[model samples]
Every structure is written in structure tokens, then in C-alpha cells.
Target: MDRFPEAFKRFEKVVAVEEIETFMQLRLAFGSWAGRKWVPTERQIEALNVEAARLRLEGAWRRETIVVRGKPHVRYRDVRTGRFIEKPF
Candidate 1:
């Protein structure tokens, strides 16, 4: 079966070759925000949550949640920047 149904395919975008290798390295490092080593602050976390909720309400298909530090946090790729944001819990 197709993991991403046809209806959801519109949300997918083609990533650049430079981004692919960087993305893999970051994933291996365990989902950092744009591959940054430091953690996000409480204010940033709250902002990310709000942004995620807003995106969902706007019918964005890319908004998602991920577990970090044993708690659920919002994760989304900013359309304007093309950067993966995994807000640490």
C-alpha cells in the first residue's frame, strides 16, 4: 500500500541535493532544529507549538508531532525556509 496517499502528495516538495546529505546527518544526530546542536528555549518551544497549530488549522499537510526528551513536540518544515524544525520537548 502507498504510505502517502495521493491526496497528501501535494504537500511533498523536491529537496536539493545539498540538503539531502545534511538532512541525513541531522537525523543521525537525533532531530535537531535545522541541525543546530543547541536546544531550544521554552519561549521558542511555545512559539513552535503555536505555529504548528496555526499551520494545521490552515490545513497544512506537513505539520507533525515528534517525541523529544520523552515528551511530544511539534515538528514542521517551514515552507519559506525549507528547514526542518523539531522543537525539543
Candidate 2:
């Protein structure tokens, strides 16, 4: 019995599902991007600070240690790989 056609269809569905899952995971992990004119207003900044303080209190903003040039540099880990990287900007 030749089940190649059905198998291929199942494989295609699996690949599509995997791709969608990856996209959703990335979106959740990195968040949406802001536009060029998206400067935070005073109120927004204050709100952000409040949220950040909440996260900090929850121990979510813990500092990470990294080795650089034979010295330890405290930095945040990259979200994708859990590796320390310098801030791009």
C-alpha cells in the first residue's frame, strides 16, 4: 500500500504548524517594535517605571554575569539563545 501521498500531506502540515509556532514564540519573546515617532511621553515613562518596578520586585530583572576579556561583565542575556550580548544601540 502506497501511503506516500498521505505521508507527505501530514509532513507538510507538521512543517506549517512548526513554522507558525516558531513565529508566535518569537513574537511573544521579542514583543512588537515601536515606530520611529514612538517616544514615550512623561505619563508613559512613569507607567513603564511602575511596571518595571513590579517586575524588579518579582526578581524578573536579575543581572547576568558574562566573561569578557578575562574579566566578568555584568549584562543581560539574549532572549533567543540565553547568551550574553552587548546592547546593539
lDDT per residue, candidate 2, 1-89, as tens digits?
A: 14333433443454432332332332222222323433545433333323333333221222467688999987754344546556422
Steric clash pairs (candidate 2): none
Evaluated against the true structure, the overall lDDT of model 1 is: 0.38
If candidate 1 were superposed on the true structure by all CA atoms, what would the RMSD be?
Answer: 14.8
By summed lDDT, which 10 consecutive residues of candidate 1 come out lowest?
3-12
TM-score result, candidate 2: 0.25
TM-scores for every candidate against the unseen true structure: 0.26, 0.25
lDDT of 1 by residue, 1-89 (tens): 13222312222232222333232242232224234633455543443334333433222124567799999987766444556755332
Off by over 4 Å in 1: 1-33, 57-89
Which is the leading candidate under lDDT? 1
Number of the predicted model whose TM-score against the real structure is largest:
1
